[model samples]
Target: MAADATKSTAGRTVFRHRLSTRAWHWLNALTVIVMLMSGLMIFNAHPRLYWGHAGANADPAWLEIGATPTEGILKVGALTLPTTGVLGRWTDRHGVVQTRAFPGWATIPTDYSLAGARRWHLAFAWVLVIGGALYGVASLINRHIQRDLAPSRGELAPRHIWRDIKDHARGRLPGGEAAARYNILQKLSYLAVIFGLLPLMVLSGLGMAPGVDAGWPWIVDLLGGRQSARSIHFLCATALLGFILVHLAMVVIAGPINEIRSMITGRYRLPAERA
Candidate 1:
């Protein structure tokens, strides 16, 4: 029995990453998290997206004023109010009853606090943008990006990509290849989110900032104007969010515990058997 246990442990394979890669991975995760939380808070500030006209256009139908912004504060109003008295009652120190607004067809409880949300969002934005740039430059210098992240020639083949997809779908990924890093789909996704989408979000966000047009007028021109930049920024944020959702789903499908451990430690244990 002891011999069998020892054999099992010996059969497992472990991989270690250099300190730079580990630091970059963790910091990237941290900044992305900060961006997500603060971005959601910021989105709550606007709470609306317009297409042709300002979201506040008088004749808008597909998008109506979901919340009335009064006193520089916005709320979600009737769209998300409690039904069936599930919110319960609150009592003041004086024993007076405090009630939640019961949402009806015409009225929903609105989300508010634009000023505070913007402050938090802008603050975290600085960290993400600066930190990401530094990480990118460092990765280039160390060749970590080229060596680890860039797809291999084998990964470029349609057959290899298809095989990875099938394995991902069927939960039958091979365990032997430690050098088998990210599959094509994963490489593409990481590239899009890290290189393309994130930079766009930061640039568009900065373009929409008040007085930015004075220093970088072309940014406004590139995005078609300040308002248009805001729209694009929001769209980019949505894309990043979608990627995060898909990533989480893949982790869950692949084996949540093991995947999470690999991310945290930068090492994954491979099973003994390989055909």
Candidate 2:
């Protein structure tokens, strides 16, 4: 695996992604999908979030997704919104009405099965943990983190970061040889998901487990409490979903052929710099 993307053949093509990176990426994609759908089904069992140490139906909920006889509503604090066709209420495949927070098509098993969803979610949770650990080791061994992900001091400056943000807002994507390497925004976003968000998600998840809470009490305390952990976990999952959507959009906008090829075959054709 090459530390940095290298150009050859008049610098038109570069070894963009390593085999390990490609493998982990695809595996992570599958794991995340299963985890998300199953988790959503689990959420359907209790479509409300609270704070502090304990929460119940009678407790004050910071967020709630439920249905009335007429329609479905999602409430965050005092703000409430109707979500009928997609969330909180929808028609099932059998033409039956569902009042779950998420639709059947969006959940694992495609039916209301908390036990089944937990089976899938817990099974994939191990994969996420083990696969992420292995990828971290591989990245360090290949210097992928240092060479590609680490931003230079100059790149970390406020002006430099602001410039990248402005460029993205203006749709001025990188091209030419510059396309081979990650820009500052890419590096920061990747780092956030890889290190900060993912790890926090795992810890918060562990806090939600009774056995883990009993044995490793500090894990729950570290996150304030079980209800707090649950809220954080939900927020983190939402953020990760947003990141995935933006990532897919970028892949489509930045030439899907080249972008998808790099992830699939570890080879990328560097786009020539824009005028």
Candidate 3:
């Protein structure tokens, strides 16, 4: 009985994130935050979204968020919603009124400079792509993607997946040895962000670049068009933001100090099971 219990608790205190993984995680986090903010600042330059091969001031937009003479409005497919201080109209740091899609606080540089924002966005974009490539190679070499992120055969069953979802909803997190490995839901979310959203973001961003489009015109064609790529980039960024929110919430719920420390130091203290 004692030997069995010892085995059960073997992974309660163990190395969770490797040094390379932790480094990549923090670097990616910083770059993603900077990119998102700067991207928003860039978006304010053209606060409209469209579909198809080409869209300009003359063409119709599928979505638009801007300030009219009367109020700030967000228009989507014939629906117009008022967004006052948060979106269209706001008091600036100088106590003067200003109109912008996203407020200064939510943007990089905190001042309206489209050129500065684009520089920041493009500079950090290379950091993200290069760091992400290194991380991906490291993960593959270490089998971290295969062993930890990929779902196991048992975890793929509908019943198993549903059970994990229910457990997560109820805050019934795993403990003991089970806590050492990521849960099915965690695995799926990581995979989606790392493999699906990140790549799509990179590709769409490239498709929007004039230099890239000039060299590889097929990229824009493959993604439908420049406008389509822009729309996809915005959507992927939004999804990444959603993932970050949920990830932070889970960290708080699970154990902020432990979870954060694990990412920082690569050591994790698994939560002990309760009676």
Estimate every model's Cα lDDT from 0 to 1.
Answer: 0.61, 0.91, 0.90
How many steric overlaps does candidate 3 have?
A: 0
Highest lDDT against the true fold, candidate: 2
Model 1 Cα lDDT, one tens digit per residue, 1-275? 35555456433656635566667667767666666655654554444544431345352323122322211212233244322221223333455433322111111112334466566667767877777888788889988679877988888899988987887778665543542366678887888887899889888887877688789888878877766676788678768879888888987866687666766676766543333
Q: Which parts of model 3 have CA positions greater than 4 angstroms off?
A: 1-11
Clash tally, candidates in order: 14, 3, 0
Model 2 Cα lDDT, one tens digit per residue, 1-275: 13233323324878899988999999999999898889899999999999978999999999999998979899999999999978888999999998999999999979999999999999999999999999999999999999999999999999999999999888888876778899999999999999999899899999999999999999999999999999999999999999999999989888899899999999898775655
What would the TM-scores of all predictions be? Answer: 0.71, 0.95, 0.95
Give candidate 1 misplaced runs (Cα > 4 Å): 1-11, 51-56, 59-111, 178-180, 272-275
> What is the TM-score (0 to 1) of candidate 2?
0.95
Candidate RMSDs in Å, in order, are 7.5, 3.7, 2.0
Candidate order by TM-score, decreasing, is: 2, 3, 1
Determine which window of 10 residues in candidate 2 has minimal summed lDDT: 1-10
